[model samples]
Target chain A: MFMAPPATDIAPRDPLLPRIVRLRGKRREIRGVWSLEVVAEEGEPLDFAPGQFSMLTAFGVGEVPVSVSGRTRDGIGLVYTIRAVGAVTAALCGLRTGAPLGLRGPFGAGWPLEEAAAREVTVIAGGLGLAPLRPAIEAVLAAGGRLVLLYGARGPSEILYPADLARWQSARRAQVEVTVDHAGPEWHGHVGVVTRLVPRARFDPDTALALVCGPEIMMRFAVSSLREAGLSDARIFLSMERNMKCAVGFCGHCQFGPHFVCRDGPVLGYDRLAPLLRIEEL
Target chain B: MEIHDLEEVLRGHPFFEGLEPQLARLVRGCARLQRFDPGQRLFREGEPAEHFYVLRRGRVALELSVPGHETLVFQTVDAGEIVGIAALVPPYRSLYDARAVARTVVIAIEARCIRDKCETDPRLGYELMKRLVPVLFQRLRATRLQLLDVYGAPGD
Candidate 1:
């Protein structure tokens, strides 16, 4: 049995002070997105599940919650994929190797991989949504479970981890189907929404577990398509996103109805979130 | 297979499920089995739409071409799916290229014959329209999602 990390019990009085870590390496994924490798400056590695996010602070510039994109099987260092959408993320993306930064808890629930054992797993990712799902993909592949990945991007130029995708496809580690919304003349791949590829995936709907991460609208459509394909709501999971402040539940910035995204989820069952997802600007 | 055998196949298809026996027979009258090799272009964009197909085996890709770049596949139609609905709708021209990606067998129905039958039999026309509406709506929804570029940067 794999040893899981102890859950955080005490709410930090100063969540920023004791959380400092150092960035070790960086790799650009696309135009504005990057994958940064980080490690603790003084202690043991941080253990995290696939869907959890860590609160990353850039000392002077503000802090933001970035999902832990990857972790060693031994639960060593962490990998974070950051999109330079705002000031804090932009700062985090700009830092070079050996840069000092603040890192907090690997908060929120993760994909229910234990329940998915021996069952077929379907992973659907849109845009940068692929980052948060990468860890799950790695775990599933390592376990030699039946896996299918349906990924969509803006175009060929915007695809993330092309090498990893190629390796997965070439090695037959998983059934990887990739699509783009649009592409130039040289592209000869699927050019439509990611949900369109879900029907083509080979899985026993009765025994399959689907994990989706993407824009809310995209996930909504993806979930609908999966349901039509015969998967139950209980077997469908989503990694949600919101403007988050404190990594813990104290700050109410990441509230979704009765649940706190930081603590209750970054990964949640679709059945629990469907109703709240319908309300506008909630 | 014989024409009667093809008719039996059509009857078994979900697309023709609940179709009136007489209408199914009429549709079968217009269908001719056609086979395509891999990489074969069944129809090209802007071509005058003459026939639509009920795919029976293998896969066909619907592709849109760009002037200076590669062809982008919009969708793939497998067994039991219909292709070239444009022949049934107005502006009778293919909007994209349909190419067989594998050895494919299809029951091709002449658009002119089907249209003539529809004009003569209002009931058949109504039933066909009702079924076609859902497929059209599905395509519309998929197109709308593509236009939103839901996979792109959230702010963009």
Candidate 2:
């Protein structure tokens, strides 16, 4: 069990504090029902493994945890697909380029990308679940490993990073497939839940690690779908979504069984989430 | 959708059964419909306030954790019952997690939106309070019973 540190020894950054070097929101756009990408200001360099998340603070409103979209030496992209139902998100929508914003950290234990080096990788994204897995896609591409991506969204408009999608399709380094919950007249892509896209990919579960993110219901379905496709619980991984106040595990808000979403993971193997995930509630 | 049409949809709900049409419409205007499959989480404990939902179809399980990390199902909501009223109170975070046991449909109204509208119209707010208070106390009573079960003989 992890214990909280002494308050004096660890003067954690106050999100509400007026720090001179502040991050600003470049723009906010609705990619789907509750998903938006906020390009934040460059403060300190963000060094995080793929699948870690940061807490976004909008002054006088409140703070929310969003996935670290990507990072380059120049700056990092903080992509948050917010369900615009609350005060912070409602205010977050109103923010523009150069508006003040607070950032806590790129916290949480990320996916074990290093542990699965030189292996076949299968990444599955359900609905807006793609937001957290974008970094891993970038990492896999950078490493030149054999990879496959299966993306599922509500529909065409709900699909994120279309330009990136196009680039991946053209480069053809990794096989990519997309599906939708409901299709419009323009959509000719696969029409079904993201789980359906898994069977189309060619991979050996023994040689591949599957990473999935999205709504808990969708993730549950995706895991079962992958297993049905011959993947085992040990080879499947998932990123969890829960309320986190202190991005660092100081608060118990993110606790799920023996693990905390902020500490042990926002990303964890199925071995952890499977049993708890099987529970009808929680 | 027109606010009035929204009210009619929720008026039949036991949670809002006695609410005036205008107030019911206000609730409806603030609501968004959500659909989830069986065994899906509706919300988790300690999550920041967002919306309160009324089940239209299916059932939702309310769960609380024990000392050993074992979760106990306190109750389940059938059609016409409300969930997430904790959003109406201050600090606006869930005290327990709720999940779906079947393909569920819910009318979720943003708590902030309803609260703001209520602040502007105290009469409507007063009526909502009248409805919610008893439900809150009843839940507390139910939780008390659950605690008794936990502390009582091995199989109660």
Across A1-282, the per-residue lDDT of candidate 1 in tens digits comes to 999988887765475454778888888989999898888876577788888998899889988898989974346689999999888999999998999998887888999998765788999999999999988988888887878999998888999999888877864557999988876544656667898888779988999999999998999999989999999998999999987788678879899999999899989999999889889888
The fnat scores of all predictions, in order, read 0.64, 0.00
User: TM-scores of all models?
Assistant: 0.86, 0.58
Residue A173 in model 2: lDDT: 69
TM-score of chain B of each: 0.93, 0.86
**Model 1 misplaced stretches (Cα beyond 4 Å):** A1-18, A72-75, A170-173, B1-5, B8-25, B35-40, B56-80, B97-105, B119-127, B154-156
- Calculate model 2's interface RMSD in Å: 19.1
Q: Give the clashing residue pairs of candidate 1, or none.
A: A185-B69, A185-B70, A186-B69, A186-B70
lDDT per residue, candidate 2, A103-139, as tens digits?
A: 6677888877886557778998865567678778887
Worst 10 residues of 1 chain B by lDDT: B147-156
lDDT of 1 by residue, B1-156 (tens): 888888888888767778878888889888899999988988999999999998888878888887786777767677777899999988889989999888999989899999999999988889889878877887788888887767666566
Residue A42 lDDT (model 1): 68
For model 2, what is the C-alpha lDDT against the true structure? 0.71
